[model samples]
Target: MHIQQLTIENFRNLATQTLNFHPQQNYISGCNGSGKTALLEALYSLGRGKSFRETQTRHIIAHQKDFYRLIAKIIDDKAEHLLGIERQTRDYRIRLDGENLSGLSALADLLPIQMLNSDHFALIDQGPEHRRRFTDYGLFYQDSRFLPAWQRYQYALKNRNAALRDNWPDEHIRPWHHQLSQTAQLIDQLRQIYLNDLEARLNYYHAELGGLETLNIRYHRGWAQDKTLEELLIQHLPRDRQLKHTRDGIHRAEWRIYAQEQDIAHYFSRGQQKTLLCALILAQNQVIQESSGKQPIILIDDITAELDPKRRELLLQFLTDSGAQLFITSIEALDTPKNRQHFFIQAGQLTPQS
Candidate 1:
């Protein structure tokens, strides 16, 4: 899906604005604090159903403004659709084609977006939560069974943890254990299959960046790989009660990346890490397109700041060939020639440049 127009008001320092956008590529350029990133965030909120940088709505609403509003006209193969959102301090209202939505997932169904910023390389350097989010976001778009299985697993885990904390007997917690094991097994199997599909794609893209093909990412099922999840969950029951938490399961699973048999982020340079993360994200993006036949709107914030000249060219070339609609922001305009809808952002204003 692609956004044809965006209307934003009371969002950060951005003034009231309604702007038309090209379907293929949109370039937003301005100096720092000129509302370049804010415009991107305005569009991002419509897709994600929340602000990209802030948890609370009040943090994103302009000073002295009670609320912020955004509207977007999106087009897909089926038809054109309208999505809108308005947020107060803690609550939000969302609409699709004039009808209200029950939750943000409904909006996400209309427009799936992927974003990358300066801190995006943290996907490798940070803790397991980052990798889990990366895995789930990609699977959420591709695997319909993923969400329900994840929900069931989470529910079972919560109840099971409660029993452990309360010192419940084995029989009392066995039922929840069974549920957790069943769901975790499904999650684990699906994740492995998903990664298997992505392995070749990851290698191909990483090699395209002129990096050596020494990438190896493996899914480590939190317990032992040899044993079944149900068997292992029961085996861990004794220690789990002592720890008062579910410690060994798919919930604790991790995706370990290795570069030339050495761990990622430890041996790789800053540019290499960014390139690796970009390949991984783009590989997942390719999986989404392969499964859904729709390329997600890609929000790239200040991409040139982090990469060297050759790596930057490689990344830009890869993005250009992806056929995905792009909304890229930068301090100064790059030398890209394929994009037609270019704008300069100065003090929250968008002036068309080409």
Candidate 2:
């Protein structure tokens, strides 16, 4: 779905603005700190349920405002859905179709989005948690049963850890362990199947985005491949008792990105790393589009950053042809074909460039 209207109030430095958006390519141009990124953050909030730049919703409020609110009217072929989000001091609420939502996935279901920002580089440099979340979100969207299985696994894992922490007997812990192992098998199987499909699609995108080295993604199922998770759980019971937490399961899932058979961070330059990450997100979007029949709104923050002139053209050329609504921010004005619309943001105000 494409955003038909965005209404923002008391969000960062952006003026109270309600603007209609193009269904295809849109460029928000401004110098650094001109509220371009803030608007993007507001849009991201409507879809993903939070700001990309800040962990705390309170931090997103304007200096003199007591709260922040954003509403987006999104439309596909059949109907239009209204997504409203409001953040108070310590709490936030999201509403869909005028009713409160219990799960943030509800918003994602309504308006799926993929974002590329500086912090996303952590998918390569950070530990397993970031990578797992990235992988899981993709799988969650593609496979209908992935979330239920994952939720059950997490529930069982939590109870098992609690039993271990409280020094409960094996009988108590083993039941939870058995429950976890069953779900773990399903989760791991789904992840492997997801990676298989994702890897195949990533190859085409990696090449299209100018990857020169041999790019590889290796999936580690968070346990010994030779044995089932049930066997590993039993074998590691003593260790799990000592540690008081799961050391083996789908929760420990991790995947590595390699270039020419070496860690990407070591073999790929910084600029190339950014491109590789963007390529992965775009490829994942393709998979999502195929599975859901709706391409997610693509948020390209500073789309030109660290990219050379030729690479910028290639990226924009690909996006222009992708048929997905694109919201991109840039420090300098960009010269694209006439189909693209431009907006200028300055001093917390957004105005059409005409």
Candidate 3:
């Protein structure tokens, strides 16, 4: 799937305008504070339902503007569809093909997007929550059963935690425990399958990117492997009561990356880490495409950060070959072939450059 055209209004500092896009590749260049990233943010919001840079609606809208709006013409499997979003301070509306959508999952399903930027390095450096979210994002696209099972699991976990906090009797909490155990097993199975695919693809891309070390990933299912979640919860009941929270469950599941059996952050340089993260994201995109036959849109903000010219060329080549629609931003125009469209932004205005 690819975006053919995008119209923006009152979004950040970008002027209201419609910009045409190349189905395969687009390079956006501009100086700092010139709204290059804002352009990418608009596209990301259309797909993901929120901005990566800012969370508050007030800040996302332009100064003195009441709301922000984005509309895009998307092509999926030879059919064109219209997707639009409008956000006000108190509410927001999403529409696809002229029909209103109550939620963003439809948008995500229609337009799968993978984003890479300096902030994404946190996927490696941050805690388990980020890693779990990373895995879940791919699963959301690959498996239809994932979301409903995940939702049920979250609901059970919430009730279980509440029961524990309230000092409920064992019998009262046991039902939630059963629900948690059943849903957790399913969630763990789905996550394991997805992560195994992710790991295999990640290593392939790592090698393709000239990585030498053996990269490995370890997934902890948040409970002892030898024991059922029900058994573990029973064993930890006292601790749960003392702590006023459920102590052991899938909520604590973690997945970590290792290089040569060492933590990646400790074993790899900054640039290597960034490259590995990019490879990981690309591998994820490949998995989604292979499983679902839908090519996701790839967005890379500040493609030059921490990457030398050689590495940048290598990454860009890989992306171009992936056959996904690409939107990349850089401070200066990259020296590449002229087949793709190029645009320069200044003071929130965009102009195509020949």
Ranking by TM-score: 3, 2, 1
Arranged by lDDT, best first: 3, 2, 1
lDDT of the candidates, in the order given: 0.83, 0.84, 0.88
The candidate that achieves the highest lDDT relative to the unseen native structure: 3
lDDT by residue (228-324, candidate 1, tens digit) is 7788778888989899998878889888788778888798988778888778868988998887687888888986786777977777677768777
Model 3's TM-score against the true structure: 0.95
Candidate 2, residues 38-66: lDDT per residue as tens digits? 98888888878887779876678999788
Question: For each predicted model, how many residue pairs clash, with residues at least 3 apart or on different chains?
Answer: 0, 0, 0
Per-residue CA lDDT of model 3 for 154-184, tens digit only, reads: 8988888898888999998888878889989
Q: Worst lDDT window (10 residues) for model 1? A: 331-340
Model 3 whole-model lDDT (C-alpha atoms): 0.88
Models, CA RMSD each: 1.9, 1.7, 1.6
lDDT accuracy of residue 140 in candidate 2: 74
Q: What is the lDDT of candidate 1?
A: 0.83
Worst 10 residues of 3 by lDDT: 305-314
